[model samples]
Target: MSEPAVTQHPYYHPQPGTAWEHVDTAGSLLAGPTPLVTLANWQEEPHHVWSFQHMRELMPSQVIDGTDEPRPLPEAPSDLSALEVPVAWAPTVEELLDRTQTDAFLVLHRGAIIDERYVGRMGRRRRHLVMSVTKSIVACVAASLAGDRLLDPDAPVEAYVPELARCGYAGARVRTVLDMRSGVTFRETYLDPDSEVRVMERSMGWAPRNHGDPLGMYPYILTTTAGRPHDGVFDYRSIETDALGWIVERAAGRRMSELISERVWKPIGAFHDAEITADPLGVAIHDGGLSATLRDLGRFGLMLHDHGDVAGRQVLPHWWISDAAAPPVDVREAFAASVNEPVLPGGWYRNQFWFVPGDNGPILLCLGIHGQMVFVEWSTGLVGVKLSTWPLPQDGDKLVATINAFRAIGRTLAREGG
Candidate 1:
């Protein structure tokens, strides 16, 4: 199966070296010798390159432990550097990775690794922050619990977390929150100091809190108010996922990290224990905060591509994967009316996964701020994970280019009988 052909875009020069390769000579580009990374500056420029891979050092975190016997991702090592992507700025796979500040890149086709690269300060053992990609991973828990009748998707958010009865989540169903269609009025503006996202950061202890601000994630969420009616157009709010985390915890009578460990990490036979940043009050930050190694994330993407299969053991619910892969027809209409439609035409958001129209079918995208992506092309049996620190929260061009690069690679490998 061939992918849609791409016109060669004008080539652009990539930076000289990996993100951390350039040292100022005065000292380290970020901090001298041993960089002084703190919660306040960890997400900032130069500091982020190091802090993203070392988040546990700056904050309280809970581990999602992997299994003693890990799943083998045998290597086939194909040269994919010359593969041309569709975007104008970075024409080839190598340049696209460098230009976009990729920390780690891996491609798995039919469950075997075809290509893998680790940039400066990145290694097989180093865990990198995946930002909003964490939402999709955490959602697995909600779906699994629901499959077991431990959770009720049609139930209102307040039913699980009664404390939210007076908040913006009032009357919002669990299904609505999973799809990010809740009427929550929180703004997602990352750079705005006064935006709800940044304020939520303070609550999660990822940023310095202002005086009189909510002390924890739950407290802050309790203050939000509804901006519109429930089941409206997709809003892409991170807090909705956080609320889902809370709901799952309340439903299963377990912590989010524990749930992920039991339901995902171990079943997938991940190589290392993944961790999520915790608030001062010890609640896992489900909106983001997950830092995991590259290969472990690849294993996760592979599991999705295989439709919940983990070495022949069914780990995720079949119904959940089916629903996410081919969502209801109305999902596309909901996404079309959203601001994201311009970037992802003919795409939809369901079961916490993003789907974009593809040559063969819809491509499942688990995206996060700052270039984190896990692209699963089920038709071609391809799964690719790219972890990056783009120095900005979002870049539409980089995001699109990365997707194209992965698609091109998948098409090539499929034709080659990979």
Candidate 2:
């Protein structure tokens, strides 16, 4: 049976006397006074509000099918909107959501839904574009394959996909790619038109292709060159995840969509069949092309919070989660040397997940451009997912505020023992 139609939830109501307000997405969609969302403008504001939820209509996608009987999200709803979060910009959590262009937000504490809200056209069933959150999810699949002995992180990437030997990934190990430590020169500057990220997006069919651009992600991968030796300082490159995705597929003798469906989505009991945008050649855009519902993402976060345990079944490898949360000392040293250190003080990157030191414990983060995040508080057993359509790809203020909000919420729940 089809899911029920989505209606504007009461939780999205603007808090009277505050600047908070819902994003008006009712009219002027693809056709109207507003500019139409095309391959070129879909990532832009105004258009992204609608395009984020309707990506399948704009591009070719592969369905990561879910189970018919979804896992239940036990509801114990609370009014967290009024909760005071320590942030310089927003006075309350509700205002933070609005200020960040949040489409959907959900919080899970000990496997129970504590708060859930939708804004504009977003609802329980809508699958919003998750951008680079896809990287963390793809890493989960890679970890699972490793646990099954189907893939080896120590193995060179070219062992699985020999074609990569001629590219920048010539001598990079699968583990190197997972931690974004590959020596490949990939400028991830989102705003720069001539950045390597934009160029790769064009090859992947995400942007309008220009003359002389590579045909697809594969050809583009070959064009990249090694900037330095492998196993160097941490570099925030999206293409590393793409190479990691290819390695897992080759090791498992399957496609990324199938690997994700069998290894992560279904195992988590996702309610909706998630969609992944594909290139013109039908290659999955593993770096940042996933679209999934809010609740499903919360479920994925919960699994990580519970140390990869779903009830009695162990879905993700326990070792993988532990290593990611608390990596070796070198990982921290490497992260501290990177450009991200100033933004994330005393943090590290491992296995595609971002880790920030918290007062209680290490916090695990799966972040995407434009305010997409899955926040997991390890010690507090709090998991939260925020899906947003921020006008700009990166906003330091918004990102810090969101992280603080989740941290505050986790602390509150831990104190209450609820």
Candidate 3:
């Protein structure tokens, strides 16, 4: 008989000094009594009890292996050892490692899983939350819809979701939302009690405890208001993704979960079922609720690496891939200027993906808060996935170093192959 799985003592808690908080609302809703999950309890081998293969029921994802089985990965160099990257920012990667505390890491290049490691309680199958990486998934859904002609990137948000007409989405175009140029006044401070993110937590059942509050996710989204005009400055707001989800649902005549399954998940041959949390009303939380295993995340990255085509089928229009990967005209300079960090310079965001404009080659990435990334370098056929439960509000220095390391590795492999 198998022994029951147990949780190890967490070394990283969302709130450092708080007690072990637990929320109860049927299950683990985001709001309510349980404090936001932190990475504290992670320990060593005693924690190997948790893995991704056993946690499939907790989230949404579709597993894809072989023409149905696991495909052979490309051969990798014998030793990666540990590469050190100098820090020229506020915090070094080592410093952030001490502060936020990271749990696991995996990197793949040219179809091969090159580097993989675990720390504390993290293991091969443990499903950690992807946070805002969900936004990029939603973006992919939107792009797929555009490819099918069900959506027009230039169309107004009102074209699909009429309810957003009076909200901050009033005059926003689909393109603006994709670029996060929607002038929404969403307060994103994770620690602020009155921030919109907190309110969202309450709405999604993620807040610590808030009884007598509306129980579903959609109502919270419906109530969001517009703060500024569309297409101005770059503001990262989860609400825009929520609005985009609504648009996708309205146009497709199905739930976002089902749409993703049919359009992306199933087609890509994912290795597990990815789950998206919902409000009591059952509307999918498109902003940041999706979760999946690291390997499956790599598969999704591979799908993009193949140019939105899998098995020779043009799953997504080539033009859609081209556009989403293209650098946005308006924000290129601003984004480039913002990349003052040593490792990443001249980075930009387009179609909910991050773009490294002037690196070894053009790089596009799907990044989530707290160290979740699906980085793709098309020029070299490289795709890397890193999933972590690092203490939130990210350590920019560590992220830059890791990205630089991946880029460096990709260049080395490409040159060797040549």
Instruction: Give lDDT tens digits, candidate 1, residues 26-64.
Output: 233453444444554567676788888988998999999
Model 1 steric clash pairs: none
Q: How much is 75 displaced in model 3, in angstroms?
A: 4.9
Backbone collision count in every prediction? 0, 0, 47
Q: Write the per-residue lDDT of candidate 2 for residues 40-99, one digit (tens) a residue.
A: 567776678899999999999999999987889999989998898998679789989888
- In order, what lDDT does every prediction score? 0.86, 0.88, 0.65
Q: Say which candidate scores most in lDDT.
A: 2
Candidate order by TM-score, decreasing, is 2, 1, 3
lDDT at 300 for candidate 2? 92
- Tell me each candidate's TM-score: 0.91, 0.92, 0.79
Which runs in model 1 stand beyond 4 Å of their true positions? 1-35
Clash pairs, model 2 backbone: none
Better of 1 and 3 by lDDT: 1
